[model samples]
Target: MENHKLGRAPDFTNACIVMFGVNLGWVLLFLFAIYGLVAAVFICLIVNHWLNWVAVRRRQADQLYAGKTPG
Candidate 1:
């Protein structure tokens, strides 16, 4: 019962569904990459801040031991 003259046109719905799935996969990958970068930057910042704090405290302790005003 198929139409011989039209030859059964291609299925646009299936094509659209495939494209949507591909685009969704790419979007998820990009999101995960961005999240990883943000997490790395955040951890670096926290470590840098902690190291600076410890250095300042050590410097203050040295100054106090030398009987200075910690200027």
Candidate 2:
């Protein structure tokens, strides 16, 4: 029975190289997914900052001109 069980065990050692290849492919895919998420967040932050800056500048300009000006 022991011998039969041993024989039935998958010969993963023999197919180790293929398994390693598959594992590496998954690792690269996971890394790329993480990189994409981080990049998207970074882009969102930059755009948000730019919009805030523009709004502040516009307010400042309005305040500066609110005081009688005909030039």
Measured over all alpha carbons after superposition, the RMSD of each candidate to the real structure, in angstroms, is 25.0, 23.8
lDDT of 1 by residue, 1-71 (tens): 46546567787998997997688567656756878667656655776798899999999999999999897
Question: What TM-score would you give candidate 2 relative to the actual structure?
Answer: 0.46
Q: Give a tens-digit lDDT track for model 2, residues 1-71.
A: 55654436577785896887688567656756878667656655776798899988888788778974322
For each candidate in turn, the TM-score is 0.50, 0.46
Cα deviation at 20, candidate 2, in Å, is 45
